[model samples]
Target: MMLRIPLNLGLLLLLCAGGATALAPAEATGAPCGGLWARCLESKCCATPELTCYEKDHRYAQCRPTGNCRPGFHHEDPVQTPWSCVVLTSPAPAPGPGPAPPPAAPAPPAPAPAPAPAPAPGPAPAPAPPPPPQQCVDKGQHCVDWAMAGECEKNAAYMHEFCMKSCNLCGNLFTNSEEGTAAAPAAAGDGSSNHAAGSSNAIDSSLRGGR
Candidate 1:
């Protein structure tokens, strides 16, 4: 019994030293959990003895010590006298691609050509010139000179008279003096010859004097 008491005292002293280290203040010894900085706790009951309450603003925060908050968090009054579990914000998402280009503008339509001008109206044709007068011709007398002088063409009767005068083959030729005056003296004593001479002499004198 005396030897067992000394060995048990040594073991009890070693166990007390380990318990003091394991239960040390969380701020002085960092976190009790290995390497893990702080825990994400929702409930007020933290499993680890070293994990105490912490906060930022008035909400619950991580299980870190006072004044030791994660990035994006500022130390605030503790809702649970030490700390609480409350998330400030989550991470933002990323961006996307882009939009497509617009379609090309349609080409403008061609302009229509101007309509052709209407043809001008033509002047009415002048009335046809009147026909010239027809010339008159001699019958069978062939009076070309009279026709050329415009006399025969002017009057056909004048042409006939002119043709007759120029030919002189027609009408009375000898006077009554040459017919019976000289021959009447030879038979003047006879009653028939004397009457005939008197009639011839009267006719001859009247013709000579143009009476």
Candidate 2:
């Protein structure tokens, strides 16, 4: 069975629902220096009865004393100052409810997975090849020449060691003897000569069964 309510009653129900949604009961306009008032003071300038003016954003201002005012004091105002300066008509009772609590902040999201482990250490470096015999021989010659040029003791020692090793390997021992001295100069003056001598010595030493 279909039951139809009176049009007036239906309309009244709708109006009631709309009124509930659209109009919240008048909350107390709140203390004069309440939320909106505080915000307004924060956003604009205000003056106190003492004929002092200051920026609302700064919170307080110095008020110069008039004939009937306090001198050098902070004042908060809702509107433009000087003209707006007026004694409070009546003390506003302390507000029953404090400022509405600020909205709760949202929680932070979890961090993403850490990046994959870095690639494994690269392969071990290749072993270096042995230096050429000729290069070693050349180093020895440079050492000897530097010594003969009156270089420092340390340099002389190094050169002596280098040349001896180079010459010995090629079966030509470097000594203070006449042969060693002559050979040292020849090796320094021309590397080709040292190589030729080293080659000949190597063959001769081999034939003579030398170390």
Candidate 3:
């Protein structure tokens, strides 16, 4: 019974030590900050009322008064963390589990990636070289030359007829000037031959009458 009493007492003291470690100061002998845990801070030069136990790191860290917090003289907007240095202005209890912080505001939908600018319009491609001129098909040199001189555009039907006839004629197309010159000389020669034949016939007729 005496042995069990002492063992129970030793277990109680061990549990007490573990609980004290949680609220223990950073300068407490063997206690070190681990994981997301931090040890309480003890006021060295500052008073307990003017100071707060903010565990800055695994090691006991000192923070000078920044004068941002009135009368408190510490960071006015202090970051909340396990080991943040803070001033005891009010109780300013640890933040509790509340809303999840709104999921970072959805990142603004990535801005839709702006469409690529359209290419600048170039000169209309030289009108496709005018489709090779329909009159050029199966046409002779003269016909092609006349058509290119815009004659075919002036009268397409007339030029098309002319092209068919001229291409078939190949090279025998007689112009008006050549026909007129040849006809004048041939008509004069025919008249002269008829006159000469008539004079000879008259001479033979007189000779036969005398016989």
Clashing pairs in 1: 53-83, 54-83, 54-84, 60-84, 60-85, 60-86, 61-84, 61-85
Each prediction's whole-model lDDT (CA): 0.48, 0.48, 0.49
Task: Give the least accurate 10-residue stretch of model 3, judged by summed lDDT.
Answer: 31-40
lDDT by residue (tens digit), candidate 2, 1-211:
2345677778999999988766533321231232212322322222333332322224333233333343233355344434333332222334578889999998898899999999999999999998866633545436445654434244546654565443333443346466775566566657756777999999998989964
> Residue by residue across 139-180, what tens digits does model 3's lDDT show?
455764464445555766776666643323222432246564
Which 10-residue window of candidate 2 scores lowest in summed lDDT?
Answer: 28-37
TM-score of candidate 1 on Cα atoms, chains taken together: 0.20
Candidate 1 runs further than 4 Å off? 1-100, 139-211
**Per-structure clash totals for the candidates:** 8, 0, 1
Ranking by TM-score: 1, 3, 2
Maximum-TM-score candidate? 1
Segments of candidate 3 deviating more than 4 angstroms: 1-99, 113-173, 176-211
The TM-score, computed over Cα atoms with residue i paired to residue i, of candidate 2 is: 0.17
Which stretches of model 2 miss by more than 4 angstroms?
A: 1-108, 135-169, 172-211
